[model samples]
Target: MKEIESSNLFPDRLYLIYRVGRLAFSSGIFFLFLSLSSISKLPVAPSSLFILGIYVIVSVALLLFSKKPYTFEFLLDEAVIFTLVASNVLNYNFFSIFLIFPVFFSTIILGSISGTTSLIFGLFLHIIFFLQKHNEGIATGVQTVLNSTALIAMFVAGLKLERKLKSQAFYIKELEKEKERTEFYKRLYEISANMAHEIKNPLASIKGALELIKEGKQNERLLEIIFKETDRLDRIVKDFLHLSRPSSPIKTEIFLPEAFQEILQSLQHFGKNYKLDVEPIKFKTDARGFYSTIENIVRNAFQWADSKVEIHCHKNNHTLEIIVEDDGPGIPEEEREKIFEPFYSKNPNGSGLGLSIVNKFILENKGTVKVEKSKLGGARFVVRLPLSEEV
Candidate 1:
């Protein structure tokens, strides 16, 4: 909408440059005519110089005023055009030919209404000038009519062309936006499909377990299974809800090694064998997002590790890199990328939301994560984050 208004309201840079170039060309032609008139000793009216001087002044004024609001600058240009046409016509009747500039400019810049006004003004001035001269009546009238008609015709043609170009540009912009929207919906559909598939299996299991418990004696084992499945579903729903919510990081200062030490202390209660090799590093960023991301990654590592998990953290220049590896069955090369996708998991008992949640938080915090083969002969997850200058 703004584009449409701008185009109709003002002459673009190309048109401005074109007008300046036209002025230069006209200057050259005027100088050439002056030289010829001097050589031939023709009695050229001194008023011609005054008219040319006035034109140059108006052109310069328009250039200076071009930066003004579109409507104001346009009206100013039209006024200058009128002044030039009136002065030139009155001084030298034949010079009304210069009316072409404003006529065409109005058409391209201000659209049809102004174009029509310019056509009428040009015709009116030229007719009045011809009457004042009162010589070669029919020829002058014929010339005036022809010139006016040609100027109007050019105005009409320019208006049509400008409208067509603007329409095409607007259409192209809309199509590009539609294409992006379509791609977004396509991704959404894929995520929805995965969610349904993941939720269906657990729901069916819970239904069967509940039926067993009701039909037979309420076995504690079956009740336990139901509770476990319910918890799994709850986690799935919680993570899904979290992912759906828009994320905005609340940044704060945090020390990397201190944060890692706290995470390790919390996990020590699980009695899992783990190793930590972290360098002392400090940075300012979203502390909650950082903690949530690292916790998910390390928890997944512990869940899959055979006996031990190795954790490593280091800072290289302005970046902090953390690696977690498990001494268990490593991820297959083909499944590495899929592991980070929502609702994608090889473990039958897994909710498959862990890595996706980690990835989401990291991305929101402007950090990155990737998976590879670890030195421990198992899967390795590496996360890199930009360190703030306050570090």
Candidate 2:
């Protein structure tokens, strides 16, 4: 689980591995009984292969998924593993009581309550099937009693281990959070300086425009300069807010056609200079962030295209792929890396925050965007976002 700590001795990975071992150990017992029944006095129950089949299926399910085990799953494991022990007790094979030790080591790896529950379930099976035989042999009775005592002992021991593991996990998780906070603040500090520089130039342009208007009179050309500079400042501030805020995108099921249509309809005022070749994909992502990404990238395409722009979208593996290309001049290889930097633009009137905003939003959504030479001999912007499996 996401809450499971990385540095703990009882890490989730180890628990998963233990489960696999649990499956293997239980399966091996069944295999032994079935395979050796022909050559030896070894007893094979009719349910041995059935139980093994269940172990395999459940083990496969547990390993394929990334989730914590349920209490009932451990109970099932108890049923399968202790089946042989109960069988052995009924057959007067006291040597097989040694199998009870393996239960302690594995169950102790879990929380005390689960371990206790498992032991109770296992002992219940032992009583129902083999407790009557305990009266027939002193050794059977002694080992059965020891099984109960070991349940209490290991349960107390498991509680302490579980507490120690949990506290360590909590401490490590906190350290990870603190480290992320430190890195975030460091980036914030760097961007604050960039924001100030971007802010200064626009303020100076507005001031100069106001001074000229004050000296003579308000004219269209001078007024336009003020408005343009004001718009630049606004764009910079909005983009800065987008970049500076923490990126914790909440994903939701998104219908791709609906999302794309929202942006396409808004940009219809620009003309039919666009062609969309999109797969009718339905997936999950941060819907708001996805719309922003589509709007910004397509708007940038329109700003650059001379005659036509094309948009293509599809799914690749677990990722959603989006490509926006235009017939405008493509970006030179050297300038491509700087394309997404804040306040960097080739067009004189551009705020230069469009691609930067696009990049920020994509990254926040656990996606990537890149520029490449389009097949149409122009710049192509490619965006990829991971698909949520729930969809």
- Which candidate leads the pack in TM-score? 2
Query: Over the stretch 62-106, how does candidate 2's per-residue lDDT look in tens digits?
Result: 767737656676666666556654544234344234334334544
Query: Among all windows of ten consecutive residues in candidate 2, which has the lowest summed lDDT?
Result: 89-98
Error of 2 at 179 (Å): 2.8
Pairs of residues clashing in candidate 1: 252-285
Give candidate 1's error at residue 35 in angstroms: 40
